[model samples]
Target chain A: MHNRNAWAIAPLMALSLAACSGEADKSADGAPPAPTNQTLAEVIADKGEMDTLEGVIRNAGLSDVLAGKGPYTVFAPADAALGAAGSDLSDEAMKAQGAALLRAHIVPGALTRADILAALERGGTGGVQMRTMADGLLTFSRDGDAVTVTAADGATARLTGDETVAANGVVQPVDGLLVKAE
Target chain B: MKRLIPLTSVLVLALCASSPALAQNGNGNGHGKGHGAGNPVQQDRDDDGDDDRREGRRNGNGRENRAERDVPRNHRSAEVRVREIVGDPPREGERAVRELRRGLERGESVVGREVIGPRRDEVRALLQGCPPGLAKKDNGCLPPGQARKIDRSQSYDRYNYLWRSFGGDGGYQYRDGYLYRTAPDGGLLGYLPVLGGILSTGNVWPTQYTYQQPPQYYSRYYGLNDRYQYRYSDGVLYGVDPKTQAIAQVAALLTGQQIDVGQRMPAGYDVYNIPYDYRDQYVDSADRHYRYSDGYVYQVDPTTRLVQAVIQLLT
Candidate 1:
């Protein structure tokens, strides 16, 4: 999919959302109670590590978008990363800059850890450069199962936890902030 | 003495053309005091009593003498210096000087790949923000922005990246082995010592990229010192210390990607000088507060004890 123009894919987003709900409802004949249909926001809130991420998404006004539907692959940074950012996000100026940076972490379509690895494998040199929802660049490199991502601002974040599947999207916890270059 | 005047003049011209240091001493220019006082021609003429012959020779050589006198002493070898510094093949020094003169006169950058002249110290000082008296004139030096443009051109040629231009948020460009900043137009920004590079003084760690190269070449080229040429993996030119291999300039590339706004700045970036217009933009939370000092606003996160941002209070 040409995800580079993700912002223009509003119709696709709605379609993907409907498709997701259909998949959730058709759980294979009583398979593990069909799993709770939680959105990415609910999954993050439930996980307890993404309090800052949850706050940022809310502040950036992307909570509704993330909750609405469609599969997004969010390399979400945990609370510690947010705290380390200090006043930048907690302060007022973050209204615009924070939104852009947050968008850089969220990809339009769900990218599983396996999918990331496969992309890296296909791009054998250092890694594959992916387009973020913020219209920025994210380079992904893999050494075995250890996946590391570099943002346009040169901030590197490594996948630290297993993926969390939500009704709307997937959340992969990262160790650092995914900052976009200004 | 009259017969010997032509031979003496040729010798004097040769010496002035070859040695820049000697030309500066007022060699044959009759300002013959101090270092220039030791010229053998003057001493020989003093030794022989030939006043009548000397007067005749002076009248005959007057046109040649006038032509020689018209040439500026310090600028005689400027052409040779330019060619030698850029490693260009030998050419007419006069033509090279004329080329430099024409470019400067037209406010165009001299096209010797930014090695404008042999006046390394003067040029280095000018680039370091110390504009010498001579550089203040348009005839002597390039207009401020054009010099920077030329320097940026050289920087692009070397690194294969358009480093941030002068005055916009400011970024680093490696040129002639020194890690330079786009500031103080036409000045040497910073010398990278072959060691740890510039130390991070604030909360942010300076982003550094060290080029990986063959160890054998490093040892061979930089035999006397620990310094090795560093270049970005994709850079066109590898950087050896412009100053010298000994006490090498540091090996690092400034990605110039430091984010100055918002929370969660990358590890290497910290807010720099927020403007007064932006002061009201930052709302103090329970955990953090903004502090105003010396016409600058600073965001202090008490827990980290780091100034999150340095905001300039724009009037």
Candidate 2:
């Protein structure tokens, strides 16, 4: 599918889900800004260190989706996250692989740390199944205060700190990449 | 009058005896549900047994034999030749073969996915009506525009009989050690016999060439925390200062020699624990590349190495 069309549908799905959950707060236009703080994009932007992810979002042309009124759960990776990736992507490769990689980190619901912890508590042996924007499942396992996120490809990332409260969603810093399953 | 009375009595006695016999037989033909000519219970059991056997055959027992027999000897021989050359093919390399076979069976042109060599039309014609004993040589079977030979002396190490198509889309790739045909769009056609090239001395093709690197200077920061670590692209490492979150590039931190860009790290170090968010972003190289990600800087795995995310490396 064309990248533009894929991204266009993602936001709509997220927005519709948000509306269903009573998460969308309307002002003038049908698309209303989040009631709380900045959007997921703004939260990342506010952090000067996350330039790589911001560049990916910009390069992949997904700035609007992240900035839109979405109840997204973004597992924001740290700058080291990109460096920790074994090799570097070319400009062309960044454009090609960035959106899919970024989408894998963003889930549909604005699930906060507490919400995740609560779900994990109720889930027992089975971890919480958070569906990513790319339509893959991220298994979240909680151990006391720390939360470990397992990607589809079996790579694991730890939630580094407290979840950031964004206007339309929640942002949690992950130590690793949430690689999509092939 | 006495004689008539006796005859009537005899007829009544015969009727009573026949009535009792008919009632015992139920259907009156001496054939009932359990005692019928056709046993429904036994028939059902036989049908179920046949179904089970059919299911078993479908599940690889019987079908496997048939599949082995059905494979064209030439194609099977090509795979055998490949195995002989490679000794044992890796999983990924085997996948390449499977891809080639599927494309050929479906009559699809594999023009773009690295199997570039011949036009789809040419390949279809050759495969559809492949002559018996179509040995590895480029028989004049292909029309003039179908295949044109190219010298692979400089770039390719193994194969000498390299042939590409006229339209610049597809052709045949015959490595001295490897054997396969490519469609016009670079899709794999299928494995072919040792097409007039010396079988490789041994499988020397690099096992680890799968890692793909992400863009340079790309970094994402989660938040300011005590756990944050820092590094310069030049191989320096620093711990994030707790109070200020400031980091400095310390060259002394690198224990071994400085690794050049594109140079794979020599195997010795242990695998650094990689975080998840960056797993999908690494680049793969033929050789190992030095990478610093997660907390510790490390080497990318020789096989399945992605420059973006950490696989396994020397400690």
Candidate 3:
């Protein structure tokens, strides 16, 4: 859907691998089943609540770019939202705005949370913008079923978890790091 | 500083052009950026005469479209290119290129309407692994033994790439005035913020259809954001947010359809960077550069080659 152009596999990870398979691998266009060949940079380096956003995406070298094949959608950030936004991550965020602050929390493609709630229900708007590979932008929106995002200075963030699903991309995890340190 | 072109009849309604898809090609022109005092473009209906028609070819029977090879005629107005490229205040680039031409003419009137129930079967299940217009209109991908043939000897306007007179892999520097994009081993990479300088590829920038190269997951370079306005076609590049005229795409280059995130992309052809091992298994990293087409590959931007990212890889 141009989350920049997905398809390393992300139909919301076949509805999150069919709600983690309780739905018996839901497919037949119910979408949702296959995930876990691992590599959204190895499920965010096997998340421990994403150890400081996985050491700032491997010190922002981008860990061979999320383990290759651009599946992307990331958003990450939850080390208690970078230690509750004290977010300096030391050394002036390790300069180069710390890899543009981890490329704003990566977005390129592979989005999920049901593709940001079907892109905020087919874009009525308030959120769904995206952008990121460091050019920044962010927006998202949808809330009840969970999703939040924001930025471009409104600085929001919400999204919680239950959406890692890999093979190529989809991460979600947030709480706040939409940005604001320097 | 004045009439920067508005001798109006709504710009003589910019010569009554129309192209539901070529009715004798229809002239059109007038988006205007002007160089030698604009408004003369009317090329289709060709007498041929070996003029080479800027190199996207199809010279003879009058087929010069890229909206009249990007209206090079002295037309002027974005309050005269923001009072000549950024002195600014031309009623804010004429109310942001007239609301990005009414939101890209209302998203190009729903791009070939004919939806048919259930969202046309979910846009035909997202055009599955090809067919139903395979490679769409030659922006790339055809060689499944030439899938019913239509190659254009490496296509053009909708871009197929490889031409610095065929040695074409990369070149163009100009710097500071901004034109940049070098990379094919030569390096340089991002620059083209645009204001002009390569005045002699001789005629159409990179010899017409603007040289082609856009896919690096496109974003940034809206002239490094000063509220955004930059526009161009075929050779990609677009940003326009001037009070929500909303288009942001910034470069597209190719599409057989089915791109979603913010949507847009699909103006037909013009996208590049098709070499680095040609599709090198759809990319692993070097930041960006992938091109393919129709069955989808795209990615681009190895430092602003342009596109930002897009993937479908035929399934």
Candidate 4:
């Protein structure tokens, strides 16, 4: 009687284990995964070259939006670019640049590097006139291997290195300080 | 023992009654002889003491009343001094001068008391000497035909003299050939030339007269409506209107997303970022996926991705 009872209990335990494994597999296959598009915050965290720009971003109090889930085209300047332009990278200078200079760097939509370059080539004015987040127009000039950007106030800046893709936006490194005309 | 107690009680009552009477009499004469007999010298002394106390009280009341009356006068004098220091009286004086000017402009005689009595003859002579046949209207003085010609010739010879004495610019010619000067109101100051003829009423030649025109409107650069250009220097943004070249310093205290120089920013485009490479172009590419020519950073629009910040930089 004892031997018969053990045999019956062993089969029931095996069936229960099998049912648990099947439920686990179904659950794994049930829902879709998270999206692959990185947010602006994710992009900044991933790209390591935006330390100086990051400081400015914080001082200008733009961390929250840049870190949010949107496709933004950020014309990011490197430490060297700011140095070349003779901008004292001081907290005071960053504060002085304020929102106006920052607005000049951003566009409304996410523009890929290829799309921007292609736009510059097609615009035919030797550059493409892109309205900035500041309502000011930024003109893009292509020279051989490098690109030059002129602000509405006639301030010119050069892109030194390459484009960086963040989860939320794209950051293009620049080599000079672009100031608004007074 | 009971009888002794009653005797003591009676003695105590007598003593209490006697004490008050002695105190009342002590302030009066020291006499209790017979009915009202007292020391005459002591009575005179008491009377004199009472009189002195009454006199002191009267004097004190008079002093207090005098002080109370003087307080308002002192306050009034202080107020007058403050008004004088603040030049309120001078402003009033200017108002009086304006009234006089208005009266003169209307060709009306001004009547006011002088330091001495009014000199009616002097005033009449001054009025009679005014050039004959000239328009006596406000800011209107024109010389007659012959006198105008003579003055013109003389003005050419003595331009500086006419400019100093008659306040005339000989070079300036009005449409009516009236030699007008620059008035304080920025309008034409007209003057009439004096002829060698005495007025019919008096033998006085009108000379050294000044004409004042009404105030005119002048439009300055501040009145224009144009976009203001801005430049950043020493951490401050300065607004410069390209059309007028008017410069205004932007206030440092600002918050929002837009870059406005003199005007307040609108609602939606309030988030801002500092511009990178403002004047020149920059090339940037990384990770082999993206590339661009101009590396101008901007504050991107959150909803529509539109860039709506102030174009502070102008060519």
Best by lDDT: 1
- Chain B TM-score for the candidates in order: 0.17, 0.15, 0.18, 0.15
Model 4 chain A: which ten-residue window has the lowest total lDDT? A25-34
Clashes of 3: 36
Q: What TM-score do all the candidates reach, one by one? A: 0.31, 0.32, 0.21, 0.29
- When candidate 4 is compared with the true two-chain complex, its DockQ is 0.01
Q: Name the 10 consecutive residues with the lowest summed lDDT in model 4 chain B.
A: B78-87
lDDT scores of the candidates, listed in order: 0.39, 0.37, 0.38, 0.34
RMSD of 4: 38.8
The clash numbers for all candidates, in the given order, read 19, 63, 36, 64
**Whole-model lDDT, model 1:** 0.39
Error of 3 at B219 (Å): 12
Task: Point to the candidate with the largest TM-score.
Answer: 2
Off by over 4 Å in 2: A1-35, A84-92, A180-182, B1-315
Across A1-182, the per-residue lDDT of candidate 2 in tens digits comes to 69989998998998788776743443234222333567778888777667777777665455655675344568888778866331222132233245446656776444556556655665575686764544356888876667898866676899875466676566778888777222
lDDT of 3 by residue, B16-121 (tens): 1111111001111222232211212211211232111111121243444344344433211101000011111223323434433343334321112110011111
